[model samples]
Target: MEFSASKRIIHGFAPAFALLLLGSLAAAQSPKKSDYLENIALCNGPGHTSLAARIGGCTAFIDSGQGTKTALAIAYNNRGNAHTINGDVDRALLDFDKSIKLDPTYAKAFNNRGGAYLRKGEYDLALQALDEAIRLKPNYGRAFVNRAGVFLKKHEYDRAARDYDEAIRLEPNLEAAWSGRCWTRAIIGSLQAALEDCNKVLQSWPNDAATYDSRGLIHLKIGEAAAAIDDFSAALRVDPKLASAFYGRGLAKLRSGDKAGGDADISAAKAIQSGVDDDFVRYGVRADN
Candidate 1:
């Protein structure tokens, strides 16, 4: 199984805001001013899932020439996020860059930029941006979680666990933190703890294939091959494309003396990802059955 890092940004790159000049009396006095205020309101509203509207609103507001540097930065960042939601990371990065230029200490912008870098698999750059985010806002639990993901990719399991701990302390309901910590615990031989963590996460996300795969590994670690096989089967039911689940179930099948099933599963897993056998062998699992 694989522990996922933050696949997407949680919030916007700028803080929420509102303009206070909109009233019926003022709207009656000047149509131009009313349009400006209306546009600004639309720009400042949450830009999620309405990319075209957000872009148009933010553009109109930015053209209105009525906002401070910080306000303009927020507008630009909002538009950038709309671009990000629309699958345009290049535009998102440009807006994030502009947002940071306007307000260098904007921790949200840095964090968003880090997430963009992480999506690109540039781990070192992601860490640098995330470190800056934490430095600017020490209580940013999201940034801590992102950094911990980088640590996990680096195979620094202890550091990943520590960051996950800090993230969980800062935000108790952070599911990603629990999932990452569970994976780290499993790799470190803390099987029972990992099982508990996986179970807790599964309560909220019962159909999560990755968590099921993780729990299966925990069961296998504890010599409960039947239980592990069941968990792995559940994982595959949820996500038939999950190569790790197939590999894991193969191991459990072999442990339970189902030789033909084990061989078929291992072959299927290797078909999905070449060299998965060598990787599992390197992971020290009993893949030589």
Candidate 2:
């Protein structure tokens, strides 16, 4: 959305920490070549969660002699993602670049570079990298999803939807693709279909507060003020700090004639994030007359 100045184009780190630290401790005690490679595999995993232990593990594996170019490529990519999660984006991009150089046809490295570009607000470069990733690996669901995010950041809603569609088609169970499509549809397309997509995501990930907030916005858009309020409340129960939920609930409350409650929620939302309503305004939502 054009409101990205207030809201990030990409959301959430998508991490699992316990398994990593535990594995790291265990591997540290007995550093075998096989064990080191194992750590590399987990650290640069598909999710690219960017945890510190992942970086450490990849570093260890890189220090060990790599068995193959593919292994080295994966280690570099994994370390880059670890850097990304650690907020050292410059280092992360360098690793992604190295990974690509190591393996000219490494699709995931290209996709990851695109993600790094998004963090840097280099939308055109991001798109080019994602395009190359998809071209190298047509079945790359993650690449399609990243491309979709780039399109969304550019406000190219239809193109975003198409990329999301392709992502879902490639990986029917990829939750992010479903949620991305749902959010995009909420902003510019069919509310009903968007609601359905939200429901589908919730059925799989019931505790996902962001999806609840997304569905709340859809309800608000469709004139279901009470429903919107309820959905927003559910989201807050899961994540109290979700500013978007507070902002959406505030609007829903006002629409339902709860002026005091509306004002309070709006204030809470802004206390959490100053420009919380820009996303809604960009989507054409307005106060009840």
Candidate 3:
């Protein structure tokens, strides 16, 4: 019942909305028109996620009547964001294409389309989309973040870290950017720095199961068996169905002289979904290897 590792990894990282080369894919408030426009400007202006929701609502409003070509382009761009948030990459790409058809200079749309391409494993297309995005918006941090993901997939950790660093400089408290940096660092064996970024993410929004799962990996790396177990257990506490946490804690238990417990946990993980990934196996304790 071992499913493809790639698929399981995709499933594990599903909630995070980060795309790997082989892989991947929030909130509300009401307001007046001026307030909405202001929020949209801030969201889109800063490349915050709120832009997706705000643009979606604005596009719906524009479609009612008095919609100009420019207005329709904006609507398409915004709707593309909504689609992306909902994991409708195909729809997102179509909306982006429409936005560009209406306004050839829609940089954000290009960036988002590049994101869609990345999710589909079309690296060249992703790079092209991101390049256009950067060309259109020289100071766009989101484009840099997206491009960094491509680099991470390609195993160009240093390049990815550089992009993540630039993104951080552009937007200090951007949680996604920070998490991307943390992940890149973790891949490159910089567990301490990765832990710092994880801490920052927790500070902004604590109790993230993924964050805990990731931190557990870091702890395992640094040889903190007991600490790793605690983190994995906490991750399971937050989200019981996280198969990786079970596998992780199982490995930790096995490594720390609890073989029976480890076997039981791995059995539990396989039961949850008998599929397992080799890369996931790589993440297990050294003894597991």
Candidate 4:
């Protein structure tokens, strides 16, 4: 199973006006300057900032007409990120497009646009935007990850693996890259390598349900039914609704000769996701196996 790539948004690129303008100098600035700085702060606040506040702050900064083209582009991109997080992909795409128009060289905006397209299931467009992002910034690990997601969706697993490899090289600590490569390698029959990748991610992020699910599949393929069951159960402990885990565990139980328990799990998985069995079939497992 291909997990969604981690989409990273670039925050505002506003200069450190707050650091430069302090005390009496900041107090001496016009009210508009103060407002502009405040808006920038709110717009580019940490991830905990409310989506509505971030969007409003970016909108305010965009409407004030006090920002340079680059600043406006950053504001639009930030607002777009807020929109994307708010589940307003159409609005996010509009903002990303506007940002790209304002500054065609803004690789982050292009990368964000690709993410929006990915959300909409427009793989070709997502690939196009991500390609531009990578072209603009060759070492953009997140862009490579997003492009790999496009390849995964397209079932171009070899390309996806290559992109994941590049992303891991560029950002060794990126959990998504490691997990993604794990899944890709598992599917490609690089069982030992995939197991190592999954273990590495679990060491850093023990609660990652997807990694557990991937490792469970790896164990299942390696004929370790008990280990597969353990990993699948671990995944379910983290994400109870993960149909893939239910399905994989069912297969493991079946292989272990617990026919009744296996059938129960398979039925439960199908209840959660009707096509989950088909996914396992595609993974080279069959119910009769």
Winning candidate number (lDDT) = 4
List, residue by residue over 138-257, the lDDT tens digit for candidate 4: 999988888888887787889989999999999888888888889888888899999999999999999989899999999999899999999999999998888889989999999999
Minimum summed lDDT over a 10-residue window in model 2 is located at: 5-14
Note each model's CA RMSD in angstroms: 3.8, 5.7, 9.5, 3.4
Q: After superposition, how far is residue 228 of candidate 1 from its true place, in Å?
A: 2.0
**Model 2 TM-score, 2 decimals:** 0.84
Model 3 TM-score, 2 decimals: 0.73
The reply for model 1, stretches above 4 Å from the true place, is 6-15, 19-67, 79-87, 278-283
lDDT of 3: 0.66
lDDT per residue for candidate 1 within 150-225, as digits (tens), equals 8877777789889989999999898877877787788778888888899999999898787888888888788899
Query: Sorted by TM-score, highest first, which candidate order results?
Result: 4, 2, 1, 3
Put down candidate 2 lDDT per residue, 34-143, tens digits, no spaces. 67646655665545443766777777766765435666676788777667656787898898888889888988788888888887888999999889988999998888
- Error (Å) of candidate 3 at residue 260 is 3.0
Please provide TM-scores, in order, for all candidate models, with all chains considered together.
0.81, 0.84, 0.73, 0.89
Model 3 lDDT, residue 17, Cα: 14
In model 2, pairs of residues that clash are none
* TM-score of decoy 4: 0.89
